[model samples]
Target: MMRYLIALMCFFTLQNVYADMTLTIMDQDNKPVSDAVILLSKESVSTPDAVAIMDQIDESFVPRVLAIQKGQYVNFPNSDDIRHHVYSFSKPKAFEIKLYKGSEIPPIAFDKPGLVVLGCNIHDDMIGYIIVADNSYVIKTDKDGKASLPVKQGDIVTLWSERFIEGVNTTKEINITNDTEQTLSLELLPPIEIMDHSMGYGFGKKQW
Candidate 1:
C-alpha cells in the first residue's frame, strides 16, 4: 500500500507539470475575435470527461459559440420559463431535443468532427454553434482573443475560427515546448451577413 500511495502521488505531480503555453489570435484590421477554438495535438486526444453547456436564456443561447472534443456531449438547458425544441441540421452530427421546459434529458453527444449549427424549431431567431474538434486538448479564446493552457511539450497545436474556411486557416501547426508563448495573428474576412445575427458577447478583453 505504501508503494501504491507513492506512485499515485508521483502521477499527480507529473500531471500538474504540463507545459504552459499562451496563444493570442487576431483578425484583419487588428481586432480581437472571441470564441475561436485552439487545439493542441500531435495525435488525436480523447477526452471523455469534456462536456459543454449551450444554455438558453431570454430567447437566445447563453453561449453562442462552443468548442468541444469529438465524442464529447453537450447539454442545452432552458433557464427561461418557456419550453424549447432545439435541433441541429449540420451534417457532422444531427439530432433533436424534443420540446422540454428544462434540461430533463441527457445531453447530446457529438461523435464526429464538424461544425454543428444549432437552431430551434419553435423559435426561428434562436441559433447556436457547437464546433466539434478532432482532439481533446481544446480551449476557446476569450474576449481578448487569447487562450492559455498547460499543454504537453512537443504537442502540435492549431487555431481555428468560424470566420475562415476549415481547410486553409486551420491547417497551420505550431509545436509546443516547456514554456512556449506565442501570439498567432490571423487576418479574417470582413464581417459577413451571418455575423449580424450572431450572439455577440465579448468576455474579458483587457488592455495589454
Candidate 2:
C-alpha cells in the first residue's frame, strides 16, 4: 500500500511539471553561456506586449546580440549623441537606416526567420547581431545561463549562440520528455578568437 501511494505521487509530480519546466545551458567548458536563445519547434504569431529595442551607445551596440520572434519590430535608437548609419545585408532582412542620431529612427519589422548581422557604415568597429525565430519563445539564457521553458512531451527545443565553436555544430535541437532530469548541461564549443582589427581605419575594410 505504501509503495502504491509513492508511485501515484510520482505520476502526479510529472503532470504538474508540464508548465514549470526549467533548463540550464552550459558550454563544453562547463561554464555558463550568455545570450543563448531557446526556441520551440512549434511556431506562434502572437507578439509580446513590449517592443524590442537595440540601442547604439559608446560606439557599440549596447546588447551586442538580440533575439526576437518573426513579425516583431525592433527599434534602433542612437544614444551615443552621435550620428550612425546602421544597415544589414543579411538574406533574411536587408535594409539600412541612414545617418541619424537620437531615437528618431523608425522601428524595423522583421518578418523572416534567420540571422541578421548589423553594421555601421561610418564606424568600422561597430557590429551587432540579431536572430529572428518563428515564435514568441521566452527561453533565452540569462547571465547565469538559467532559463525557464514551459515544455511538453515530444517538444523540440532549439538552441543557438554566437559564441559557439567554429567548424562544429553551432545550433542544437533537444527532445523533451517527462522523465527528463531536472538539469540539462549542454556541450557547446567555445568561441573562435579573431584578430583585433575593429579599430583599423581606412578603405577596403571588411564589410558585413
Candidate 3:
C-alpha cells in the first residue's frame, strides 16, 4: 500500500515540474515564416554544450540555420566527392575546415557567443549561419513558423531572426506561468543586395 502511494506522488511531482508555452511568428503580411530560428535563455540557467553542422552533397550547409549554446562543437563533414573549404569570419570563432573529402577530421568548437557566418571557398554559392546562444531552451520554427518553448514561470524569452532588422521590428516578450499562445508580427525592410563574384569559375563571365 505504501509503495503504491509513493509512486502516485512521484508521478504528480514530475508532471508539475514540466511546463509548456507556445510561440507564433508572423511576417508583416501575416504569413508564417517557415525558416525562422527561435532561441530561449534565462538569466540563471546554465549554458549547455554546443552541437555540430554537417556538410552534405551539392556544397550546401544542411539546415541553413543552426543554434547552439556557448562552448559547443560544430562538426563540418564533407560527404561529397569533391573537396570543400569551410571557413567562418564571424566574431565568435574564426576557423577554417581545410580541403577534405571524408569525415576524418574533428569538429570545430565555438566557445564564444556570436553569429558565425560560414562559407565555402570552393563553392561560392554555399552559405550558412551558426548562432551560439547562452542558454539551453531553444528551438527552430517549423513550417508554420510556430515553436513551443519548455520554460518555467517568469522566464524571459528572446526571439531573433536575420530577416527582421534590429531597429525596425518589435520583439515579443512574455512570461510563461501557464499554457499561453502569443503571436509575433514583424515588418521587415528590403534585403540588402550583395555583389555576386562567382563568375571566375569559368561558367561564363557575367557582370556583378
Candidate 4:
C-alpha cells in the first residue's frame, strides 16, 4: 500500500514538472494589440484540429480576423438584410460563398496553412483575414497587443505579420530555462504606399 501511494505521488510530481511555457508579445511602440494571434509548434507534436469563422451582420465578418489550427472549419452566417458573396483566393482554401441572404451554405474547411483573405463581392471595402496555423499553442493578442503563450524550454517560437517587410526587422531567441522573463524589442519599417479603405475600418496606418 505504501509503494502504491509513493507511485501516485511521483506521477503527480512529473505532471507538475511538465507545465507549459509562457510567451509575451508586444509591438515596437510597447502598446498592446488586442487581436494579434500567436502560434507555436514543434515537429514532434501532432498538429491540432481546425476551427470556424462566422459571417454576421453590418456587412462585416465576425471577429474581423481569426487564427485557427489547420483543417478548421469557417462558418459564414449572413445576418444582414442584403446578400453577400464571400470569397478567398488563398492557396490553402480557395473557395467562394456565392450570393446568399442567410445561413444557407455549410461551413468552409481550411485544410492547409496560409493566410486566407476574405472579401465580399458586393462590398468592396469589406475585408477580413483567416490565419490557419498548425500549432496548438495559438492565441490572439489582448488589447495591449500582448499575447501569453504556453511553451516549453528549447522550443522554437516564431512571430508573423501580414505587413511584415522583407528586411529591417529583428527577432530574439530566448532561452526559457535561463530566465523567467524575456522581453523583445523590434523596430518596424515605415508603412508602404498603398491605397485602401483600411482607415475606415478602424485600422490605423502601420506605424513602427
On TM-score, the leading prediction is 2
- C-alpha local distance difference test of each model: 0.72, 0.73, 0.67, 0.61
Winner on TM-score (2 vs 3): 2
Q: What C-alpha RMSD separates each model from the true structure? A: 8.1, 7.9, 8.2, 7.8
- Per-residue alpha-carbon lDDT of model 4 for 89-167, expressed as tens digits? 8777899888987666787777787677888889987777787776455667654555655555565566654334453
lDDT of 2 by residue, 1-208 (tens): 9999999999998776566566677777778777777887564547655668887766777567788878889988876667899999998899999999877677889988878889999999888888888765645787777777777666778877776654222577877664343445665666433333345321223323
Which stretches in model 4 have alpha-carbon errors above 4 Å? 1-17, 43-51, 166-180, 188-208
lDDT of 2 at 127: 80
Flag clash pairs in model 3: 50-72, 52-75
Candidate 1 Cα lDDT to native:
0.72
User: Candidates ranked by lDDT, best first?
Assistant: 2, 1, 3, 4
- Candidate 3, position 125, lDDT: 86
lDDT of model 4 at position 10 = 96
Find the 10 residues in a row with the least total lDDT in model 3: 199-208
Q: Alpha-carbon error at 18 in model 2, in Å?
A: 1.9
Please, what are the lDDT tens digits per residue for candidate 1 over residues 40-60?
654456756956788776677
- Between prediction 2 and prediction 3, the one with superior lDDT is 2
Clashes of each: 0, 0, 2, 13
